[model samples]
Target: MSDRQKGLIDALQLVVPQVELRFCARHMHVNFKQKWSGKSFKDVMWKACRAYIKFVFDEAMKEIKDMDESAFNYLMAVDPSHWSRHAFREATKLDCLLNNMCESFNKIILQAKDIPILTTKYIRRLLMKRFLVKQESISQFEGRLVP
Candidate 1:
């Protein structure tokens, strides 16, 4: 582990409820490689990721173990080096709420930074517009029907 991660773990050790250190899913998929691609493997990997999203990390691990014990054990043993589940779980609790916020902030900065600087009113209007659109889209996105 780097000095940064070690320091983070040390800080987390002091906090109650523990910390979840998650490896980003997109980051892992780009790094790990397989000898021969197979539909079953992809399905299993996605299933494991979806399980984590369900907010039941242990259940996800159990699913992975049932699918392939050896692979799951390998992943658990060297998790941060190979998987995102442990990292995500460690960073998910109350103390780490800024993770997602930081991502969203970064995205907004990246998109808006290049635009001409705006006054406070303009920024507020922009935010309100985005909020309304997002609120409108939520129901559609939440539904599971084909549209």
Candidate 2:
């Protein structure tokens, strides 16, 4: 997470003690690449992120340290629970690294998002129309499954 994001999380944690924060591996990789560039480094970084077992994660970290101690130390300074699958809370059942769905939804609502709060009626009607169109299309499906 960026310094601003970390600050926000820190503040939020004071208010909501139970809030669970997770970082996107894609963003972490991009940040890491900005400092260290190499296909081998990228592969090892991803390997560490994707490791589902502590032993596997440790082994990958060993390889990273062997290749570049600084890179390994950088990763060690960050919380593993935020980036590595091995330390994720089982209750969340979150299996993905990136928030692609949220990003896609933001893109889909880009036009609607620009409407001023004073003119909510126009946005509301637009959203209603969109919802109706989606409902009609969904109703056309003959199978039991919606997808």
Model 2 agreement with the true structure over 9-98: per-residue lDDT tens digits: 788779977866777788888889998889999999898889999999999999999998999999999888888899888897876777
Q: Rate the local accuracy (lDDT) of all candidates.
A: 0.51, 0.81
Q: Which parts of model 2 are misplaced by more than 4 Å?
A: 1-6, 112-147
Model 1: runs farther than 4 Å from truth? 1-18, 34-36, 52-74, 78-103, 110-147
Report the C-alpha displacement of residue 131, candidate 1, in angstroms: 8.9
State the local distance difference test value for candidate 2.
0.81
Reference-based TM-score of each model? 0.36, 0.74
The lowest-lDDT stretch of 10 consecutive residues in candidate 1 is: 89-98
lDDT of 1 by residue, 1-147 (tens): 112234665566577334444444443433332521356545555555544344455666676678677656655664542243334444344322124565675576565565676544565777899899987887567456745
Give the C-alpha miss distance for residue 63 in model 1, angstroms: 9.1
Best-fitting candidate, measured by TM-score?
2
TM-score of 1: 0.36
User: What is the Å distance of residue 24 in model 1 from its true position?
Assistant: 2.1
